[model samples]
Target: MRAPSGGNGGNAARLWPGIGGLAALVALWWLATGAGQAEGLAARFAPSATLASAAGLLRHPDLWLHLGVSLRRVLLGLAIALLAGVPLGLLVGGVRAVDAAVSPAFQFLRMISPLSWMPVVVMVLGVGDRPVLFLLAFAGLWPILLNTAAGVRQLDPRWILLARSLAATRAELLMRVVLPGVVGSVLTGLRLSIGIVWIVLVPAEMLGVNAGLGYFILDTRDRLAYSELLATVLVIGLLGFALDTLARWLHRWWVPS
Candidate 1:
């Protein structure tokens, strides 16, 4: 226990550098925006009046609605990805012929950037939440699929043999043995997928949703409300970080190290 505490202390110490780096970035941003450091640059490429402009926008009557809308869409996309990705991955990883036949195409499509699919999705779905959800789910699916397949492939052969020896049926072996064994990898994939979804969401929201952080960003820019825009950007980043952290905690608690 003492050794584990010492190890944790070491990790905490290492984490300080990242905190320092973030502080340095904020300082740089402040200086650049202030009159002293980048006055000429600010004149050419202004940081906008966000720090001052932030309050009214933050206090805007509709702020929560916009944020809530985006959050709902993101969660919807995430759920769809988890449901679709895990099963498809299991199919791909469990059978050799299926993996060989389908993996190449999936890989090819996954390599395509999410933004590239935007136009097609919009045209096909004709705008609204459905299109946005599709893009988010598409962006988020690859990680879970690839990771789950890898996990399935890397499973211990002995576990399978033991299951066989115990007179377990094929269905029982898969349900009790295989699923749990690959859960760690599935969580890892979900973490990666969450990150991807968060990143893609902003642009996806620009597709004419009446609400959402993405649309809020556009509104701030159009309204020239820099502070609110800055605040929205900060909120976007924080939300993404929160989602990733939640996934990490889930992985740490629910899955074995």
Candidate 2:
């Protein structure tokens, strides 16, 4: 039989380590739960129970509803961030005067935790999806804004000069030259923003939203459904993983070598 190629061997070498590590972690988790003993909270929420709960949840209609609500909130928040951040980033990055004026305040506000604004947000937007959206948008905005601004700053000055030399109008310059140059940075920001938005979505959903993953988690805990709670956590992890993978694929597609 012919030996496997070096490329295939190398790929297997890299892949197996990750698979092994994950397997080790799962083994440790199961062992730590005393191998499915019926005693203790750890045992009650063992990996097997969690997996079973997750399987059961797949059959539950309410799970889909919560997932849908959470997905909607995340997407809406990201949309709001994109609409606001891109323009603001363009203004801040393209104009030195605007950058100097806004930089200090923007940095300061960005450092403050989005959760700190929860009370104020709730008061301003009141209960329901609006407040959750505000928080998620707030969480997502800074990364997008900063990355876009950085992209703008990194753009080749020659491109702008060439456009200007051609007597391109300001609108044409922005549309044809500036926007394309910054698209990679904008996508990077978007990837980061999605992760932030997903993280914030759960806590934001805890506010007044009747339907969302966060609400389901709370409901599960209240009803003493520990296994279901673990299942929810697993679901969150899986969904976040899938979203990040999609973002990465999009980035690669947009900025191919």
Candidate 3:
């Protein structure tokens, strides 16, 4: 028989540690939930029960609708943030006057939590998806704006001078030079923004939206469905992981090491 390849061995080496950690986590969870004991509330939240509940939830069509609605909100909010943040970031980074003027106010607003605006947003937007979108956009905007500005600041002065010497128009300089240089930073900001948005999404969804993962979680709790609630939590984690992975892949693809 052929010997095992080094690549396969290395892959196994990396994979085993993650598997071991998950196994340890499961063991701890089992113990905490009374280790299969038949008569406790904690038993309802045991790993076995949660996994089973997750499986059942996966088989339900309604669950997909909730997932879709939540995902749509995330995408829309991200789009809004990107549209607003990039131009503002470019303006702030490229112009010293703009930076000096707006930086303090931006810092002040950034310090405030997105959730703090929940009541006012709901009052203004009047419930449903609008408030949730606003909250998510607010949460996601800072990272992208900050990172894009940093990218612009770090850009090579020689590149700008070269473009100007070549008689490039302002639009050409921005599109051909500035944008290409900052793509990596923009992507990094997007990754960070996705995480922030996902974290804010749950509570933001509580503001009168009828269908979403957050609403489903509330429904499950109201019905005393502990296992389903846990399952929903797992689903959220998995989805977040997927989003982060996609972001990482984009970064890797665009930015050279």
Q: Rate the local accuracy (lDDT) of all candidates.
A: 0.85, 0.93, 0.94
TM-score, every prediction: 0.89, 0.94, 0.94
Comparing 1 and 2 on TM-score, the stronger one: 2
Off-target runs (Cα >4 Å) in candidate 1 are 1-12, 34-58
Residue pairs of candidate 3 with colliding backbone atoms: none
Question: TM-score of model 2 relative to the true fold?
Answer: 0.94
Backbone clash count, each prediction separately: 1, 0, 0
lDDT of each residue in 1-257, candidate 2, tens digit only:
99767988897989999899989988988988887775868866899999999999999999999999999989999999999999999999999999999999999989998988999999998999999988999999999999999999999999999999999999999999999999999999999999988888888888777999999999999999999999999999999989998999999999985
CA RMSD (A), model 2: 2.8
Q: Which candidate number maximizes TM-score?
A: 3
Which whole-number lDDT from 0 to 100 does residue 139 have in model 1?
94
Residues 12-108 of candidate 1 have per-residue lDDT tens digits of: 8999998999879776776667643455535322344544444555686687788788889888998999899998999899999999999889989
| Candidate 3: residue 95 Cα off by (Å) | 0.9
